[model samples]
Target: MTLPDHGGLSGPEEIARFIDDPLTSSVLTSMADICLVLSPEGRIKAVSSKKGSPVTGVVAGWKDKVLSELIDSMSTEKMRKRVDQLAKDAASPEVSPPRWVELLHMLGQGETLPVRYALHLLHDKRHVLMLGQDQRPTIEMQQMLLNAQIALERDHEAQREIDTRYRLLMDFTSDSIILVSVGSGLIVDINHNAALMLARTRGDLLGKSLADYFADHTRDSLVAGLEKPVQVGSAAMMEVEIKSSQRRLQLSGKMFRASGEQLAIIRLSDPGAGVVADERLTSNLRQLFNHGSDAIVFSDRDGNILAASETFLNLTDVPSASAVRGRSLAEFLARGAVDLRVLLENARRAGQLRMYATKLNTDFGAQVGVEISATWLDDQFDPVLALVLRNASSAGAVRPDTGSGQDQNMQGVIELVGSSTLKDIVSETTDVIEKICIETALELTRNNRVAAAEMLGLSRQSLYVKLRKYDLVSKDEG
Candidate 1:
């Protein structure tokens, strides 16, 4: 039905005339910086943009141009589709959904600026109003977000690859390895060998208490042994009899942290059934210790030498074991009597004195830097102290290097004499020396805790304690 051109009414007919009026087109232009009036054929009937609008640079000569001509090839097809949709909706009585399309506005300089156009089919059925929003900033932001998502996906894929390799190695190893949660005694992971020895599938053993699988009487001992590594900072071994498998197995456990959670790795091995073989192995180990590369010495409680290895005799520049016999161990050590007292005192209390860096004075009057590991062997028929001395003089002195040599270090200590008490100066000097040794050990071992501990002749627990005392751990790691 057609409406009178100049009649006032309160229905769709009146609204249609209002939308067709030029005043409504001007109002639409005010709503956006760039506006376009398009015919049903997708040709631009009018174009308008606010003064100083960036869109003016690209859309200046768009009047009377087809919508397809004003936009790039891709947007031309999209505009055609939108126009077709609009025509179909105009024929129907239904109010169609608003159509939004992103178009590229072409310029004379061969550059294209992205334009987001909101299209509405006017009541006239012959024209469409297009309001454009500059989409450069929004599109650039979206592209950046897409790039970040891709990078995140790549990181996740790489992590998966690493996990896969780790899992494969753990499973294929012959060693029976189980990963257990420290908080709960439940096994979190197990290798193929571990799964077989437990007489259970991997799924059955995972998340199950390891202690529960053993004899009821041995559960407490088993748990305590597994947890020992956390305190000692290395693997501790214990023998446990598995009730399910009816086998005696030796378990060695090491504690570790991953993702801020404490975990323990327990390895199970069976000792072969032979007493004679065990005795032979014991003899072999004893022979190795006596003939080892490091100088070995056994002394009485009073530091009198009882026995000396050939290496020790060579180190002390003594001709034979008889020549060194009955001689006080301190006579050849740092400051002679003082160094011997310190070693005996520490060994008596802790049963061991390890990595004690000091000078060993030889028979020729030459001093050699050595690291001493002495242990109190009180369980023997005759109580004696065992010392293993590793020559470190050839490795350069243990004194802290200030870039200058030993003379400069000695001079610096002498310079502290006027301002500091003797005790204070000695304590500071000792601290500096210990710090330098720890740093060098860490560097030489490439920051590997196990290797560094061995290099410094200290237990892993001792090294960790000293690391904390000296505040040597990196701030980021802490």
Candidate 2:
């Protein structure tokens, strides 16, 4: 969150410090999980965090939107609960409680998502406090959840040896399970657990056609293909997949015809799990080697590949996985790792190397080039790299030197207008009459609108509009 500018304050006075008290300013400046303060009517009032909270710097462009309206924060159930709880907790005089949020899965680059939340209300203070945990685990989370679902299903009958064991199994399973009226495909039975998982109430789900829940693919197939094929009984295990807001779920189901009533029970889990019933992940591993999106050449720090994904081998026109693994990046490129000097040096400084390009060659003299970005997961920052290798088009978008970066930063704006980056901060602030100094500083600094504007801008307002358009005025005619 950038503070507004203060035009001319004699000695190193930042505009942010002038408008907000030092305490408030410290909270705003602290590298903690960011706070989003909303008004009772639900508009955002302030965004800040306690000094000691865990998370640090965040990306730009998401600075000042209303909390409820932000895309990344809106998607998680955890965040939804926090917003609701915080809003309510502010009302009661009951002893204030500590609240926090958790973010379980690693969202894509530059994304912030909370997976769980804890809430505390400061009734006397009329504020809410939240501490968020970054639970952004790797893809291992998907596999772990998949394993958990399988274990839940397998031991389900042991929990209850009664006839209701089947019912309990159908209801409490982690994967989405449903009992459908086979011919009509209406959802005859629904479970509380699955309902909760799906963010749906039992009333809303019961008696609804299963077709209503599925996407066009499943709906179309079930509608045209087989409303009543022969009940396959024990051999009836079938798998169907549907996309959810966050991830894909594949459901395995079985059907039986009894007294002219067709009852079907379905079990859902990750896509690859159903086919891996024997817990043999060999086939899935094969797909990783042969069908992945990137040309993955797995290697040690010294660049000896243990394996290469099929996409990688194909791109280089290499015929065999056998020939690829245990080869060095230098060997795969057929020359040596160019740009490694800059890459290794930058990664040493940043822990991540991004948008950098290089060339590589394969066995048959086929040379292919890619922009490879990597993040180090190694302890003490060893050379364990997770690469995002992109083609030329993806590469060209991120320029090392561009006016885009220059226009986006207030500091850059100040520099562009020939102002000292430090002097114009007072102009971008909210102090009464602070804006005039900002305008004068810009003028005195010889047309450095950014520096002047920095001292004169705001916590929120037309500063954004002017930033995008570059229109600023020193004279307040009104």
Candidate number with greatest lDDT: 1
Give lDDT for model 1. Answer: 0.76
Off by over 4 Å in 2: 1-289, 379-383, 393-478
Q: Report the C-alpha lDDT of model 1 over 119-233, residue by residue, as the tens digit.
A: 8877666778788887776878999999999999999999999999989989888799999887777899998898888889998998898888776434456667767664456
What lDDT score goes with residue 89 in model 2?
59
Best by TM-score: 1
Q: RMSD of model 1, in Å?
A: 20.9
Residue 349 lDDT in model 1? 74
1-478, model 2: which lDDT tens digit per residue? 2223322222111212233355644543453444444344444444443333333323122234444555454344665676577656556667546656664423357554543434444333444433333344434587799899999977876665664876777666676777777677788877776565445788898987776555544544553334444463342333343334443555556766767897777655666645665456786666765676766554555556666677777767778888776666666442254243334444555777666655567677766677677665466655564455554435454534323423445453445344444345444322313333344434332344443344343432455454334434433211
Residue 83's C-alpha lDDT in candidate 1?
A: 76
How well does each candidate superpose onto the true structure, as a TM-score?
A: 0.47, 0.24
